[model samples]
Target chain A: MSLQHALLGVLEARPMSGYDLVQFFDSSTAWIWAAPQSQIYPTLRRMERAGLITGDDEPRGPKLTRTVYSVTDQGREELERWLSTPHDPSPPRDPFLVQALNFDTIDAEKAHAVLEQFITEQEKAAAEAEAHRQRLLNKDTMLLKERLTRRDPAEHDRIARLKAHVFAGVAAVARTRAEWAREGQRLLTED
Target chain B: MSLQHALLGVLEARPMSGYDLVQFFDSSTAWIWAAPQSQIYPTLRRMERAGLITGDDEPRGPKLTRTVYSVTDQGREELERWLSTPHDPSPPRDPFLVQALNFDTIDAEKAHAVLEQFITEQEKAAAEAEAHRQRLLNKDTMLLKERLTRRDPAEHDRIARLKAHVFAGVAAVARTRAEWAREGQRLLTED
Candidate 1:
């Protein structure tokens, strides 16, 4: 559902073919919402059936017809409703944490390797999110610039910051998990 | 697959019926790994079929029967392998963050309400994780005590701390998000 809403928000900026939409998600917006083309295509069809979006086949070249999608009035309304409505908090599904929790079952050397790898993974994630957050804030990304044009000039600052908030949250969570991995490593005691 | 390993970890401590396993998950362990009876039952059967576990029908009452599950030697090896293996980092799929990212499409008043609700939900989650982290440290939970008995007396403290590490990570992430929500509200700026 969120993926559909995310796709609508992107298409709301400007109409795009499914190929462009896939590229958009894969590039600038993948940090917040990453959907494979397999999921994206099927969901797009469902959204069209639901009358939230419209898709029309347009000729790209001699051999290919690309289906371009645009958010309908209903889609805009749906996106607004989704943005305003409070969302259910994501439930805890930390498989990595569960793995760490069972660290007592493994030897100290193996546990050390696991904890060190976890730290590396979290640090890498924190770095990626922080970099993307800066891109949005600087309006360096093409999509953010595109999104800004649709908003009033006076409102553009707030719009970019709103999206940047999501990345900041991602970075903060990754950093915290990295620190917690350190805490878990300390508990080993080597006895 | 992690759920299967988590279930193995718990059953490794002591044999339990599916009903008891479900209740255990609903209570002490839900904070880390939660699976509804629907998922647990099927996965347990699948594990049995795979020779990772064995379930034997036991007499419950007059003309009544219950199945109790025990981890096999193969299951213990599987759990050990999983504990030692590095887990893939969970990809970011924050629907709430996705909702916030599109807040530019909503009114300020509605955005304020959404942010406030998120703060409240995150605060409640932080409090729950902190409480459970304390329970693990104090050995207040029956499950932790049972788990400890299965380990060497010398290793009990480290074992408990390993589990508590997961809850601590959960609490830290929740606290960070609550703070991020505050940062987001400051961006509204009302100009």
Candidate 2:
């Protein structure tokens, strides 16, 4: 995702300090996207310089001061323009799969260990996705469900069903991969 | 995925010219990973220089000669070593999602138009994935299924089921996403 657009999104919602925006990302969108504090701070300054956001000076103790940012009308317009434009395809790069396919060159035991490590990492991801889904469910899911329940029965039901499907699919894949790794490790040990 | 690893994968299966490696990528792994011809050719030359693969001089047309690549024993060993290593997380960075997040800043109609274009592209992907799945179903899938069917009903069934799940999951997700896009288009139009 474009850092600029994401910056504009939070700003458009409400004026916030760079720190606040960083917190917002951590809490709200960290599941699907993540940005380091380093990246957030630099982008905030750059956006202010570009006139996309205006920063209000807020004094700190002695040396360091914070700047609260609000999206400029131009920034909002730029975001809108971007939204209307055709999207370019992202460059394909997946290092993990690369490692998987190259396994034949390495020791079988090592390949098995790597797969085990991958399973561990995926478990963490699955946990994070679960937490994010729960937060979303808490915030908006009930309201959406109520609205859908009252509306077009079939369409609403389908959409309601799909939200469940997406979550289940992600969880199921993670669990299955973990199982495969465990079995692979066991079989490797036997060998 | 790393182009270096992908090249080795094709070589491990059988020796191939740089041209043939490119063709293999297009036919098989292009869905999960892709490397441009520009990147592939340069990498092949580098791999040869690094002693990863040896280039066989084969006669082409009148003037040009083809260089076929075979993985060196060292290269095979290197690939094996890599497989045993833990997979590094490669975070997804999608520009389109960035645009969507800031969509409120743009003209709603234009934003919807962009989504419409994406739907068209997704439809194309759905078709391609369906064809691929069908091809696999006819060949490798049947072999897998036969193995599953003839094996010990309890012991062999679990692994067979898991593998089937992976293949089916990919196909289902693609089909569902395409349907979601179509429905989303209608929602945008109505709005």
Evaluated with DockQ, which candidate comes out highest? 1
- What C-alpha lDDT, on a 0 to 100 scale, does residue B52 get in candidate 2? 88
What ranges in model 1 sit over 4 Å off? none
Q: How do all models score by TM-score?
A: 0.96, 0.67
Per residue, candidate 1 scores C-alpha lDDT tens digits across B33-68 of 777889899999999999999998999998999999
TM score of chain A per candidate: 0.93, 0.68
Q: What is the interface RMSD of candidate 2, in Å?
A: 6.6
Question: What is candidate 2's lDDT per residue for B105-151, written digit by digit as tens?
Answer: 45557766776776677566656656655544453543344444544
Where model 2 places Cα greater than 4 Å from the true spot, the runs are A16-28, A37-46, A86-91, A98-123, A140-191, B99-120, B136-170, B179-191
Give per-residue CA lDDT, model 1, range A23-104, as digits (tens): 9888867777778889898999999999999999999899989999999999999999888999887666778877877887
lDDT of model 1 at residue B83? 89
